[model samples]
Target chain A: MAQFRLQGSKVLAVDLAGDTVKARNGSMVAYTGQMGFKKLSGGGDGLRGMVTRRLTGERMEVMEVKGQGTCYFADKATEINLVRLNGETLFVESDNLLCTEASLRTGTSFTGLNGMASGNGLFTTKVEGQGWAAVTSHGPAVILRVSQGLPLRVDPGAYIAHTGNLHRALKSGAGWSTLIGEGGGEAMQVEFTGEGLVYVQPSERMTLGGEV
Target chain B: MSYPPQNPYGQQPYGQQPPPGYSQQQYEQSHQATQAGMPLPPQAPPYQAAPAGQFGAPLFQPPGGEGPQLWDAGTLPANDNVNPYCFSVDLNGAYYLQKGKMIAYYGEMRFSGIGRGALDQLLERNFNSPLHASDWVVAEGRGKLLLADRAYDLNSYDLEDGNLTVRSGNLLAFEPTLQLKQSIIPGFLTLIGTGKFVAASNGPVHFVEPPVRVDPQALVGWADCPAPCHHYDHGYLHGVLGGLRHLTGIGGASGEEHQFEFIGAGQVLMQSSEALMADRSVGVIGAEPGIPGAGVPHQQQQHGGGLQGLGNLGDLGRRFGL
Candidate 1:
């Protein structure tokens, strides 16, 4: 098993003892002890996942790190968040997934129109199984819990990932005013319901519907 | 060679003891006094201190794990900052927010643009800046609305019968009680009346008393002060060589040659870094005579109007070392 920790808020230090972890390709800043880096073509999801990723445009470049020391990973100085999963799935954007334990299975799932509004394509990366995975955000990510009746609405640009059972629906605030260029700048939102946790960064990425 | 006095304003030198009643502490005390004296609205949520672990060191252990603080709707602070980069507004009635600054929210909230017919009366009273109409929207209903801007440091300031002028892009949202108007200064907006507003800065914001000259890019806003005037370093533009450098770029000019000079009694807000927020159009002023930024086309105003229109004249002059 590999243990994940933070070396400051931006760097993720994973201690591996004859275990393997999949990370963003070339995200290794530094490490100690023996380490081997192998590029995982098609996100190491096997041939089927590679074809699915290519078709869905949810492409991810992954590398497998197997070593006996503390391996460090960072991506563009983004803040790293650690999620511990137990027989559950984590739905995250490929751009936000920094690393995942080899025990976890990675795949793609259709996100419907919510993906089109966020400009992240119709498929999102899904990490399942019991393990620790790392996600990246523009700033420190705020973890919000969605329970029965207490629904959460997120601007697509700030949404990074979520876990547990949840239903996501595209909520549009666009009205006649939006067509006349007087619409709410937040014309589109993703409404999440059910029991789960949502990861939202404190910043917004420019989206197609951002200006409207 | 003798050097000219750097403190050309003839005021107290920088870092010296400020006169009585003008100290930073006194300003903060008076600021708090005003806040304390103000009456809270009926629907306004009770203000809560920001969560302890949201900033700096974690004072309390995480609820159930070793990760960041997990905030549910009930745990979210009411009308307070979730972190330095994010502010959570406990929304009941309404708020005017800059376009697309919302990151997330809990509960039921509807965002509408200023052009909605129902908002006309609200706009007439609180929003007076017609040019900025397109960039602002109204958030109404019940919920905790989160606001952020490019992950910049966010802070909320309360105004009690006071006024503040801020860079247009730095202001994120405000209550309806505050009447927003265009500042006389280009690219700045002024808020008047008693209300709370959230603003974003590239880095942490430092509140400094007036009698200060600040780099334009570092200035976030100012409170209860007259607008600042541009001050060029006289010594930098003194000699013939200086004129050549200024006009022809024969020698590189120091970027700090120009600053916004502030004097009198008030507080000025400056960011820690020189990085500026993206410029938001303050809307086109009427092309009337004597308006500094008027008469020029909107696109030309962004690049600074005068010399840009001359075009190759400057390049041609630089070629001959004019």
Candidate 2:
């Protein structure tokens, strides 16, 4: 088992004791002990996974790192978040995944119209199984919990990822009022209900739709 | 080894992680069921707030864990920062925020554009920037609202029987208890009375006692003082080379040409960076006579008193874009 920890907010330190982990290609900045790196064609998801990745355009180049003592991974100084998975599923943008354990499975899933509004993609990357994984963001990600009576409304551009059982609906306040430029600034939002956690970055990404 | 040059598209070619749950195959099995109109089982119920060693569901970590610190409707702060870059305003009444600064919120909240609806009455009392009213909104009702701006450093100040003037673009939100008025200087607004307001800076803000001169680009705002005036280091402009450098960009001119002079008893705020922020106009004061930046006929404008013999009226006229 590889122990995943943060060197700081920006650097990810994963300790591997004769185990293998998959990381974004070229993300290794430094490492100690003996390590072997081999490029995994098509996201390390095997042949069919590659085909699906190519079709979805959520392609990622991953490398398998074996027998590493302590390996440091970082990408452009972005803040890294570590999530431990005993057995739940995480849905994230393909571009936001940094690294994960080989025991976990990565795949693609269709996200319906919610993707269209965020200007991300029609399909998002999904990770499953047991193990630890890393995610990156422009700034620290704030995790907000949603449960029975508390439904959370989030700006599509600020949303990064979320977990647990939940349902999402694209709520819009746009109308003739918006046409005349009197539209409320919070016109476009994604409402999450049920029980789970939603991760939102402090900064928003510019999408096809104007800030809403 | 070369990692990808920062994504040319700026946003693409990037990462994500997920905590393990019951199972991926199981979620997929139930995901399809839920997608097909069969109501799926509810996820983990709102777990009691995580204690020191025990973790809650996906959203929260144990008190000392890497998971996010959870703040529910009752636990969120009233008018404090959730983080350095994000502010959580517990709005019981109304607050004015630059349009589109909100990232997320919980509970009941209604956002309305300014200068319209019942908001006009509210604006009539608290707002004075009519021309720029379209770029603002009134967030009313009660909720824990989160506000952020482009990930800049944000700080909120409390004013008790006092006042503050800030650059229009830097002011993110303010309480209705403070009356906002246009400052004598262009591109700034003055808030007087007692309330809290949030502002953003290129970096953390450094508060300095007044009787100071600062680079205009670094000056964020000042409190309880008369308008600042320009101070030029005219010693450099004494010779012909200086005149030529000022007129044409041929010779290297020291980047610092002037500074804003602040005097009297007050506080001056400056950001670490010198990059200036651009803001929309707070409304045109009309071309009335005697108004400082208003409608004076071009010919009547005066020349700079500092560069007397070196430049004449024509050169000075162009300098101020008269």
Candidate 3:
């Protein structure tokens, strides 16, 4: 087991004792002790997963870190979030996934049209198994919970990830007014239902549907 | 994937079932535990329970990261900020928000354009900036709506039977109870009556009483009684050499020659920095003859109808008893 803790808000320190952890390629800022780094093609999900990642455009280039010391990982100094997963899956943008435990399974799942407006692709990365996965965002991520009868609506640009067996539907508020300059700028949205947790950044990414 | 714009209200789309949920009991306990900063007793498997509150964007890291505090729906504040950069509006009726500013929300809500719709009557009452019509939307329903603007510093102000004028671009959202109208000053919008509103600034906002002169770019807005006028320091315009230098920049001009002088009573709001939010045009007031602020354009008025370096002398000649 790797001890995942924050050295600061922007850095992730994972202490490993001979076990390996998968992390973003070239994300090491500093480390103390012996460490081995190796690039893993296809996110270490295997050949089938590699081809699936290439096809879905949710491609993640990662490296395996095996050692007996504390390894630091960071991405352009963006805020890092550490999520502990037991068995359930975590769905996140491939670009936002900074690192994951080697034991976790990584693959892609069709996100329907929700990715079209977000421009992250029609697929997103799914991480499962027991491990701590670290994600990044432009600003701090606000974790929101959606339970039975209490659904959540999130802007495509602000959405980062989610967990649980929730159902997602792509929604568009576009109409005759949208054709005019008077259209609501938030003409597109993603609606989530069922049980789950959602991650949204305090900032929004520029998306195809953002200007409507 | 295809959610119709007019989907029936209160109906779940796509045959989605809520899944066997964490009993309300378990959720309440974990929520309390997290709120109390108590170690979660592992009432449920970490894999089975949904993580509530915040993670990732840590405010401050303790000696060791036990993890940041989380805020679930029950704990997320109503009509307050989740962080300095994010605000939450507990919406039971309606709110007017700048378009595309919402990051997330829980519950049912419908966002509609301010133009021709059932919102016409409401828009007629609260929304008055027609040029900015394209930049705003009316969100109606019940939910906790989160808002942010490019991750800037956000603050909410309560206006009770009072008025405050703000740069159109800095305002994020406002309650419908406040009537919004175009300010007599172009590029600014005035909100009258009561209710609360959210505004973002490059830095935290600072308040100062009027009878003060401020840099135009640093000013956010003012509340009541203070009238803004242009001011210039004419110390160097005494000789022909000075005149030529002022005209050619040969002797250099003090960058602080111009400022907006305010007098009388009232409060002036200023952001720490001069960096401004992108301007959203409130549109022209029309070129109608005899209307005081019509046709001249705001830029020209603010700049005194000419370039700053050369226009200062002309403006001085026009001022009384200078």
Candidate 4:
């Protein structure tokens, strides 16, 4: 467990493994996982030197902060980016998780939630808060906010953050023939609906895994 | 096939029948003429006669006919010691700034496309510049200056070693190395002059001069003062993928920026300061005092127009010599 301190509505803590301290507002909930960081001067002295190193591409472990107030976690993963969104919501992710404060929500039921298909099982760890929430990512994420009548769909793994109110559904790109190959057709999908935000990693899962 | 000439009861008409065996040659000629269609009216040849020893249209054909032939494939003598200022691409295509006038790659001047026309103005006026202020335009960049739309009111003063100097009326300077330019916005001008600066709304700014001493308070100032402006973000977005022309960048993915269309309107997006480098989500804060459209914040609107007149009107009224 990482140690965290509270300041006003914000919580600051050092990631024991990653040696980095993270601060977040109490109104926000953050999850932690093993992510990478690189060495640099920690932005603030209150932050430990080890934490700064982690921020600069040093890998650290991951954890989830349920209640708000800032919480810090570290991992041995590199590449960290923070994205901000509307309504003071922030989304955090590790390994190419591109989420922002605008995408925080508790539920899903939107047009773009599940590739235009209804009843798709698309679930995002939603956070409903009114403060700054910090998220991390290995690569950049593309945020797209679709409006009413127009929906959005994305690969579940590619989603780093999203809003809660957007409806959730599952879609299958595989047709009947393709389904036969996979124990009777279970295609990968996570659909979203209504008017809300969706964040996608710039690269698709196929390309990213190919690189690895 | 041979046919007896229609003689109207064995009488030959003028220009109708030729001597025997001449018909085959005539048939061949007619066949070729019909296949080729009517001949074009002969005019002076398009290209001047190729000088001796110079390759011409025939050279365009592949030597073995194995690969598709392309014109202008042969390499020419390389040019040495070219200046960066001389060779750059504007809207139309690659061009060279020879003497003072800009010369296009194809030597034609009339622009045929809107994108090229915009590119023309960008490269000629905004490349490798920190600030360019004329009567109609203003530009800011790191080593390259970029004049945004509606910028003709700019001054032409070259900075040494790509150093940027802001004129009294001008309020923009960009650092080339960092590829960032500083321009006027609420609460940014005075603070940017000092290395200690702040970006209020999560805007990306290249430090013209490094922060001599990194102070947390100063860093806060740096974080709070300059929120990236709207037009600049568009420009940066257009050029972001230039770094990776091949892969792992914008070029490899789409080789184009995705344009979102507005409902029944031209493509216009609401500009905000927080989404400077916005990737996934955009955060918008209506700092305009009082709820918009309910009651106009008269004082806020007046001050928000700019920091120049609102701050100095009172002082200027008192110090008049006349």
Best by lDDT: 1
Ranking by DockQ: 1, 3, 2, 4
Q: Top model by DockQ, which number? A: 1
lDDT (Cα, tens digit) per residue for candidate 4, span A1-212 = 33333222122232334333323212223435554332223322224523533443322232223332333433223223333233433332323232212224322222343422322222222334432334443232333343343344444444555542456555443444333321111133444555444554422233211111
How close is every model to the real structure, measured as TM-score?
A: 0.84, 0.81, 0.78, 0.23
Residue B132 of model 1, lDDT score: 85
In model 1, the Cα lDDT at residue A17 comes to 99
Using lDDT as the yardstick, the better of models 1 and 4 is: 1
Question: Deviation in angstroms for A43 in model 4?
Answer: 26
Q: What is the per-candidate TM-score for chain B?
A: 0.73, 0.73, 0.73, 0.17
lDDT of 1 by residue, A151-178 (tens): 8899999999988678999999887778
Relative to the true structure, candidate 1 reaches a TM of 0.84
Measured with DockQ on alpha carbons, how good is candidate 4?
0.01
Residue-wise C-alpha lDDT for candidate 3, range A1-212, written one tens digit per residue? 88888876799999989889999899999899999999999877889988888887788898999999999999987888888776778999988999888878888899877787667689989888887889998777877766666688889899998887679988888888788677778888888897667888888888898888
DockQ metric, candidate 1: 0.37
What is the lDDT for B16 in model 2? Answer: 14
Flag clash pairs in model 3: A81-B56, B53-B70, B53-B71, B54-B70
- In angstroms, how far off is B217's CA in candidate 4? 48
TM-score of 2: 0.81
